[model samples]
Target: MRAFVAIVPPEPAHADLDAFVAPRRALDSPWRWTPAHLWHVTLAFMAEVPESGIDEMVEEVAVVADSCDPIPLRLKGAGMFPHAGDARVMWTDVRPTDPRGLGDLERLALRTRSACSRIGVPTAGGDYRPHLTLARSRRAVDATSWLDAMEAYSGPAWLAQEVTVFVSRANRSGRPHYEAEARLPLGRR
Candidate 1:
């Protein structure tokens, strides 16, 4: 299965970002805006996981969650993937509420990746910059203007209480949709 680990923000956070994106989505543009329901902050993208290995993966993730406490996070700022010069994906940063603190989400990503590594599946290799995807485009485009407008956006603060493994699939309309395969509460052994 094509799966990933993520934290789903609470309703207030969604409401905050929805207000920000709803207007921009109405305008005709090249970007294919993601529906509000699909918004998430990916911890690790495990592109391919064998069905037989799923149970073990979930167990490892549960262990990681027990060792990690619930984190206070806020969705803020904006940026593009593969640099803004020629960008294909746009997103809002997921960050700790405190200006200075241990990097909670980054550590979570590393632990998630480590768990998957133990399962013999390597996650997408890269330095983790936690962010919630907002939109995508087929071709690269200059997004400075969009970045400037979104740079100041800071959504509602929420507690990251649980982590989920999501199975990705394309719906009838060809839009990507995610289904939760496993959910584990943070700080629960």
Candidate 2:
């Protein structure tokens, strides 16, 4: 199955982002916007894991979760990945700061990749920039209007208590439908 590890944004935060994107959804742009419930910060893309490897993947993910603490993350601002010059993904920034010290979400991503590495799957790649992906455009957008819209988009502060490993399946709509394969609680340690 196609899979990925991600930090699920708390519900209140999701609602906030939902309100932000609702109006923009009608802009007639060449981008596909993600459903509000699907908004999340991807920790690592685990790629395709056969059914036989799934059980072990779940076990490893639990270990990583137990070693982590719940993180307080606030969604803020907006930016396009790869810049507006050649934008593909449009996302909102997140500030993962709290619990006195340590970047819990960032470390969790590293540990997730590290755990998969031991099994020779090599999950670690890309600089970890925490953001909630809003849309993916086939063509670059005039982000100026979008950026201006974001200025008034406000969502509640959220506490992420768990990370989820999901199995994704592409459908006729060309959108990926996701199912939770495993959920690992944070601050278990």
Candidate 3:
């Protein structure tokens, strides 16, 4: 099964992002708006895990969750991938601007990757860049007005206290549907 580990956004943050992106979606460009409930920050993509590996993943997540504290995330800025013209994924950027600044979450991902490797699961290909995926555009949106609107949007700080392992399955629409296979909650340290 296709799987990935991610930080589920808090409710307020999700709602805020939905409102922030609403105007941008009105632009005369092709873009698929992500469902509000599905917004999250991906930490690692564990591809094609065997059915037998599910238990191991749960165990690893428990260990990591127990060892770490929750991360306070701040949402800031909007950005496009592959430059402004030939864009593919549009997202809202997030960073740990607090004193600890996502340090705990970073360490947990490293640990999760090492643990997953033992079970023959491959992790994400590149360095972790935390962002909330807003849309997958069918065509490049080069509208200056839309870009300006996105640039002016901002959201408040939110808490990330749980790491969820999601099973991504393609639905009848061919769009991916994510189900939380398991979640590990991080209480205050």
Ten-residue segment with the worst summed lDDT in candidate 1? 97-106
Each model's TM-score? 0.92, 0.88, 0.87
Sort order, lDDT high to low: 1, 2, 3
lDDT of every model, 2 decimals:
0.86, 0.79, 0.77
Highest lDDT among the candidates is held by which one? Answer: 1
Runs off by more than 4 Å, candidate 3: 141-145, 169-176, 187-189
Runs in model 2 lying further than 4 Å from the true structure: 97-102, 169-176
Query: What RMSD value applies to candidate 3?
Result: 2.5
Score candidate 1 by lDDT: 0.86
What are the per-residue Cα lDDT tens digits for candidate 2 across 1-189? Answer: 677889888777787788778888988877799888788888888766777887888888899888887887788888887886567888888775566423767788888888977775566468878778999987766676666666565567777788898887777898887888888898788
- Pairs with backbone N, CA or C atoms under 3 Å apart (clashes), candidate 2: none
Instruction: Name the lDDT value of residue 122 in candidate 1.
Output: 76
Tens digit of per-residue lDDT, candidate 3, span 30-98: 778787788888878887888788888878777777777788887777778765666777777877758
